[model samples]
Target chain A: SQQGEEDPQALSIQEGENATMNCSYKTSINNLQWYRQNSGRGLVHLILIRSNEREKHSGRLRVTLDTSKKSSSLLITASRAADTASYFCAKAGAGSYQLTFGKGTKLSVIP
Target chain B: GAGVSQSPSNKVTEKGKDVELRCDPISGHTALYWYRQSLGQGLEFLIYFQGNSAPDKSGLPSDRFSAERTGGSVSTLTIQRTQQEDSAVYLCASSAWLPSTDTQYFGPGTRLTVL
Candidate 1:
């Protein structure tokens, strides 16, 4: 069963615009990680935010976690056409190695 | 270094037949996982293996779904008596099992179509 739920099933923005996506989960998590998938390929790890972390930035990507609200958000700055793909938020259970992933947010960057 | 790899990037089989999907994780990684993704859907966790310990099969959906990792390097997922609902992309991933959160490297995935 999936532990996370992403909002705004799809989002479209012009190049250079910033895009934000949100995810909410049901149970306590050891950590939350984001991944990107292009077309039909496998997913690539993007960023990870531990339960203790509130915010993290990696290059153009910024992520914020709110353990109190049981939610997280991913922000992409100066988005480009290359950023068009599906983004997923996965939750790692506090005491287990299993990762339950959300349905994902499909982001389309119009050139 | 080579990333994780899976065999038969695409597989088409008839219902009631059996299919085996393979995954070769990055060298020296101690953790591997299997997930199933239906069309335009989130991945469903199927199973997990960590080091030499017993695998965690709690996520498996049915008795027909089974997996095995040989020598802690290569793993295979087998679906017996395939059903049409079994059609989906089977993805494999591996992690280094670090002290904290570990990032998983994935394979291209095998697209299984049950006719």
Candidate 2:
């Protein structure tokens, strides 16, 4: 079974708008990572937020983790058409090296 | 450094035939993983290899699926008696360490279509 579930199965937005996706998990985790996948390709690692951290930033990507709530959110500011892709959240469970992934949210950024 | 790489970007095979998917992890990466992604679906964890330890095969869907990592670098996933339901993108990723404080780099993946 999957340990994480992402909300908003799909999102559509115009370029230059901000897009946010949320994910919730069922178990305690050491870290939560986000990835982006283009059509017919493998995933690319975007960012990772540790359980002790509340927020992190990398270029246009911002991620927040609320361990108390077992949830995390990814914010992509000033989206571009190139940003159109499926986003997934993977949680590294406590004491486990393997990551469990969520169903993912598909984001389409129209230019 | 070179990233993770998988062989045979696309494959089309008949049902009941066997197939072998290969993955070559980044040099010095100790953790390798296999995942399956169906159309319009998220990735499903298949197996994980950490260093020289036993692999975590808990996520394999059935007995037909099996994998082996040789020398802690290259891995292969073999499916016996392929089925149409098994058609999907098989992805491979590798991390430098366990617990993944470091990012896991992914390969282009192999698209398998079991006809």
lDDT of 2 by residue, B1-115 (tens): 8889999899999999999999999999999999999988878889999998999999899999999998889999999999999999999999888754778889999999999
Q: Each model's TM-score?
A: 0.96, 0.97
DockQ of 1: 0.61
- Model 1, span A1-111: residue lDDT tens: 467788889999999999999999988888999999999579999998999999999999999999999999999999999999999999987666877888999999999
Least well predicted 10-residue stretch by lDDT in candidate 1 chain A: A92-101
How far is A100's C-alpha from truth in model 1 (Å)?
Answer: 0.8
Q: In angstroms, how far off is A64's CA in candidate 2? A: 0.8
- Across B1-115, the per-residue lDDT of candidate 1 in tens digits comes to 8999999899999999999999999999999999999989999889999999999898888999999999998999999999999999999999999314788888999999999
Stretch of 10 with least lDDT, candidate 1 chain B: B97-106
Judge the docking of candidate 2 as incorrect, acceptable, medium or high. Answer: medium
Which portions of model 1 show Cα errors greater than 4 Å? B98-100
